[model samples]
Target chain A: MSEPISGKSLHGHLDTMVLAVLDKSEAHGFEVWKRLEAQAKGGLKLKEGSLYPALYRLETAGLLTARKEEDDSSRRGPRRRIYKITRKGKRRLDQGRQEWQHFVSVVECVIGAPA
Target chain B: MQDLRVHVEKAVRPVVADQGTKLRMREELYSHLLEVFEEERATGDDEAAAILRANDRLGDPAALTAELQATASRVSWYEGAIDRIVHRQDETEIGHACRLASRYLLAIVPLIIVVVPTVWIIQTLIGSTQKSFLDLVSDSLWFGVPFGVFATAQVFFFTIIAHRMLRQFDKPSWRPRSIGGVFGLCAVSTVFLLVSSFALFSILTGNPRATYELMMPKWLIASSLMPFVMTGFVLARRREIERLEPWSSLEIADET
Candidate 1:
């Protein structure tokens, strides 16, 4: 079995990943975690608690906005702070994607491609 | 639900953030924990086992708290003002330092306003018996400069203690402990300053009579009252700011 990518190793990319997740649709904290988990397909190992600080950082930077609303879907739960990415956040994600591609190409060139 | 709430509280307890941020964090964390717990239960685990598994997946509370604090939304009005003033994108490093220094000086304005005039009046009355104008001026500078410096230092010390005490007010669990800590600090600082002033006076004049008659009573009163006075002022200013700008509005982004 392949070793799962630890969340610690993905710290720099977490912001972009979060932006990417939110770009699909606005989601509350739990839903974001669920989607990320589903998308990573067991290749990513993330602690649930670590997601909040990233959310807060993004919100503070005006890259995303959040508001609390009642979750009708949940039978027993508090109001969820639904987060959505801002236009600036979309621009940042585009930039991040381009940079990531360039970085991958450089590394692949140096490493002579994956086996 | 209650179990998840308790878990969230323990996890977020160590985060030193404003009350609003803490509440939002607690609610969000609790919501997430509940979801995790329910998912675990669906896998046939009992309530206790599901809760345990959910918490384990949430990771260590201390580590989470540290991360949360790192990105903690700053809600203090002074912090907001300072960031606005000092953190301009175009501002150079030296300009940033200078602006911060100026803000520190501005913070001590009340201290200077209260202390300088009081020191002058006391010096004038004490030196009334002096034969020459030069003697009075000399006496004022001799006593006033050191007193002013000591008073400034005391104000800063009390302000720091008061800031910490005020921060504690955000955590309901910490309120009683904070009050006791404040009183303890006040008593300790009073005693410490009294002894230090006596030593300072003796070293300056080498005359116990002069120190006792000239400085001790008034200086002692001022030094002893300073902690209470500063704490009261900080509390009052905080209340006024809260009145003007509600804590809810201090969040970085308005609700959408």
Candidate 2:
């Protein structure tokens, strides 16, 4: 089995990952984690603790907005804070995508494309 | 589920943020952990084992708290200054006491200015009668100069006493008690000064009844009102100190 992706390797890209997840649909903290994990296909071993600070950082930067909603589901818990990506977040995600593409191209130049 | 809540509380408890931010974090984190716990349970794990797995997934609480504090919203400069004054985390006890005493002395400066002139004028009017307007004006200036000097010296003496009393209480926790002690000392000193002044004036003029009739009622009124004034000042300052408490807690958490 391939090595699982560590949170340290994904540090700089967490914001982009969060914004991308929320951009598809606004979700609470747990759902956001679920979506990201689902998208990574079990390869990303995201530390649940790290996700929150990233969310808070993004919210502080005005890249997303969160509002508390009373959860009516059978599995009762505290009010869930629903996070929605802002227009700024989408713009940042686009910028991040371009940067990633450029980085990939630079790496491919050094080590040629796979056969 | 209760275990999950407890774990979340422990995780967020050390985060050095305002109440609103901390509360939000607690609720969100608890919600996230609860979901994780339920998922683990769904996989046929026992309740205790599920809690363990959920906690493990969340990672270390200390590392999480550090990150949360780093990413928390910034406090305004005014709030930060109040926190610094309230905690004085970097200052030695002696330094903090000196600063507090200096602030007390500085606040009393305007009160001294107003009181000294008023007292001089009142004394001059009461002392002189059956005299020309020119004589009255001259006597007022003569009384004002000496009274101003005396009042300044008296205030400086009291301030020094207050400073020394403050230095005795090395622990910050004793500050409120020390303030009350200082105010009580000032009240007692004011009454003592009034009695002494009365006795001195009687001796200098060579008439006890005349001195009492001329100065006793006025001085009594001024002395009686001083404690109330001091009480009001203390109450206002107490309110400001209370307002600093929440921010003070953040500073305390940061130190830990």
* Candidate 1 interface RMSD to the true structure: 0.7
- Per-candidate alpha-carbon RMSD to the true structure: 15.7, 15.1
Candidate 2 segments exceeding 4 Å error? A71-73, A113-115, B76-255
State the lDDT of candidate 1 residue by residue for B1-256, as single tens digits. 5556656666665566544566678778877888899899999999999999999888777778788878875443344345445544446445555555555655566555576567667766897553455555577668766665565555555555555555545532333346776777677667767776787677668796889888888888877795776467656666444532322233322111
Docking class of 2: medium
Give the C-alpha miss distance for residue B207 in model 2, angstroms: 36
Per-residue lDDT for A1-115 in model 2, tens only?
8988998899799989999999898998989998998998998987797899999889989999998786577766667889999999899989988999999999998889675
lDDT tens per residue, model 1, A31-80: 99988989988888888899998999999999999987765774566678
Instruction: Choose the strongest candidate by lDDT.
Output: 1
Candidate 1 lDDT at B157 equals 58
